[model samples]
Target: MESEDITIKPADKGGGVVILDTKDCVEENLRLLGDTSTYQMLEKDPTLQFMERMRGLLEYGKERGIINEREFKYVRFPRVPVFYHLPKIHKKLQKPPGRPIISGIGSLTANLSEYVEHYLQGLVVCLKSYLKDSIQILNQLSDFKWEEDMFLVTADVTSLYTVIEHLQGCEAIQYSWQCTLF
Candidate 1:
């Protein structure tokens, strides 16, 4: 009786590609190098522990006359020592600049609260000083005999916040605070 041939199927469409197992490949390459007498000696010797493989490459290059004594000295000594001693220079010279535009007006108003109170106090003091001078002037003009006849006209600003338009109020507040409102 004749047997049918078996066929293999591919994996799912979205599944990743399969790669070759490199463990055995690397182990075989290491085995080939381990067969040498120098490699065997390097494995036994504690002095040749760190750069055993690099020493083999350097010896091979020297035997091939690809690197001379002078060239190897400069390559392995002077240039490398200079690189170690040099200080690490930063890329950017200075830190980034501050923001180009202002932020919230509310923040500005909040910060100016104390200053505003101080300013109002100063203004009130100045107004009181002026009033005293004006009273003195009026008393002098009235010829020393003080009359009880006094008429004062006073005006009250009602609903100052609500009555003023938002944009105009902001501008006025900014002017009073001596700052730009955002």
Candidate 2:
């Protein structure tokens, strides 16, 4: 497969791999990455800039008593994030789509992401629609009374992370944080 100029990805629905021409994969990925409203081209690496901004934010939080000195020190430095995607072979489009994944596992903001996730975990699980896993969906569905005229539908939000307005998302986090405090 490597010698033939192809790309391989795990299937979106089934437990197998989907292989496609490399050119087609590149084109599909580029189409998603080319959206100016969600993404922009950077001439230079933004790693330093990102680190500086994170330090400033952490320092401000420390000063405001929102974050402790130790926490600020530990969360200051962030490594670069890796971006990749999985092919959505289940979709019946002319060209198969890709689901963009920005893995923050070892990135500069990884620690911050983990912190926020930990803070929100309890509250999130308590919500009405929260499901620990896809299998849990069956438990919820079982409680529902099925009607002949009604239909069960599921929807997937495309490029959900990229399309979210930064300020609005931050405001939402802030709101959720405040609600948890009281």
Candidate 3:
């Protein structure tokens, strides 16, 4: 791909390199959520609506001395619309039939720093698995005398947290964790 094609114009100074377009990212996220059964649960849970109603009811109940101020102030509930994209697999056909498929998943979490560290750790594990698979494929291909050029490309989102919209970032994290939790 050309430089312009690959380049992602950052929304802010600290944001990392983003090769995939925003729309593509959103689509990929949706696909991941759908594939992993996260989307279904989200659809079933009206979290935002429930929160709004709860807040109103709590406030009203507090006026009637039914609930305390502490309860109202620190009503900790999972926020809706957590933004996290599913892993993206990019397949490059170096040679027609035997191309290797490489995938990278990115998450924009509420706690960016923590998420970055977590993403890095996950990436390491993924890379190890991918490397092992590639080696096996290469060994098998060599034994069969199948001469085909192949390359595996691994990519990462350099700094995701600082750049994404706060709402979207939260959504991404929620979606990502939902998959794991479920």
TM-score per candidate, chains pooled: 0.18, 0.79, 0.27
Clashes of 2: 2
Top-scoring candidate (TM-score): 2
Per-residue lDDT over 15-65 for candidate 3, one digit per residue giving the tens place of the 0 to 100 score: 333455455545555555454422245446665676677668768978999
lDDT value, residue 79 of candidate 1: 14
- Displacement of the residue 154 alpha carbon in candidate 1, Å: 4.2
Total backbone clashes of candidate 1, pairs 3 or more residues apart or in separate chains? 0
Model 1 segments beyond 4 Å from truth? 1-108, 128-150, 154-156, 161-182
Please rank every candidate by lDDT, starting with the best.
2, 3, 1
TM-score of 1: 0.18
lDDT of each: 0.38, 0.78, 0.47
Better of 2 and 3 by TM-score: 2
Q: Residue 28's C-alpha lDDT in candidate 3?
A: 52
Sort by TM-score, best first: what order?
A: 2, 3, 1
